[model samples]
Target: MAEGGKGSRSGSDSDDQSAVETNLTATVNKVDGLEVQLVLQVRGLKPKGGLRSFLSKFSNHDNPTDLCANAEFTKWDVTSSSLSIEICVHTEKERKKKKGKHDVNTVNTETFTYKISNFPSEIRPEKTTLEIKQPPGETSYSFIVLTLQRVDKSVSWENFRTPRNS
Candidate 1:
């Protein structure tokens, strides 16, 4: 029957959709004095002109296209203290700049302030880690650990302050 054939086709389409995989990578950089930026890059999206592409436009699903990174810092000096910083980046398509009559594509970078206290107070760089959770699907409940090591070895308290007058 025609209905049965249509149902089979839909099932096949769903299978093809599930076969699409999304890959993400996170990187951290210290741009300025005590200013740290975390960048999340997403790949493996369905190309233009396809069923998946059309469905993505209509669906309200929160795909991994957009990602948010949160950094939590914990320190214990007699008492335990914590600080949290969150930053989010929208997909390339979602972030478009209007240049005259046409839209211009530009590299999008999301940034958040990272306090020096987040790192151990020492002369050497240290390793810090954060976990990223993906959206619900075949890879649902999955977590990715991002390990970032400070690249600057000369950061110290003296560099952060000016000399006091006697």
Candidate 2:
């Protein structure tokens, strides 16, 4: 009977983990030229007493996705348009330096932001790709392949300099 109970508990934990993964998948959208936003809602992760507090030390809800963007600079003729991307983090940090007040570990109850810019304009169409790699020891990743239609709106922020034949 004890073995059965342990198996059931493990199954339940697996279900919880699957739910957490489903919640983490974010939707990406273009907020403006050279800017995009990844949006998601996260909740319901409570570890045991001391473990909860201990694990919170490594949690960074802001920019949890660790999003990164890339483009081919050799295929297209790009002008200097100051291309850039930004991420906004809405969580508050625990101020350990302040005295008397207890430090509060913030959760992912808010949105986070990240930004990257100064992309070269000489991007080409040599199979440009955008990938979001998972953190170390993780098994999942999100990927998007470049196509003409996807590039049309994505490369609209700046003018591209057409590639020169070799």
TM-score for all models, in order of appearance: 0.21, 0.20
lDDT digits (tens) for residues 1-166 of candidate 1: 0000011111121112211112233333333454333333222111223465456546542332322222111211211112223332222222244566444333222222222234433321233333344444532122333333334545542223111110
- lDDT, residue 81, candidate 1: 18
Off by over 4 Å in 2: 1-82, 90-121, 124-128, 138-166
Model 2 agreement with the true structure over 1-166: per-residue lDDT tens digits: 0000011111121112211111122334333443433322222211123554356446542322232221111112212322222222222234454587665444222111111223333233232323332234432222221211123344442333212110
Show the lowest summed lDDT stretch of 10 residues, model 1. Answer: 1-10
On the 0 to 100 scale, the lDDT of residue 59 in model 2 is: 55
**Best-matching candidate per lDDT:** 1
lDDT of 2: 0.26
RMSD of 2: 18.6
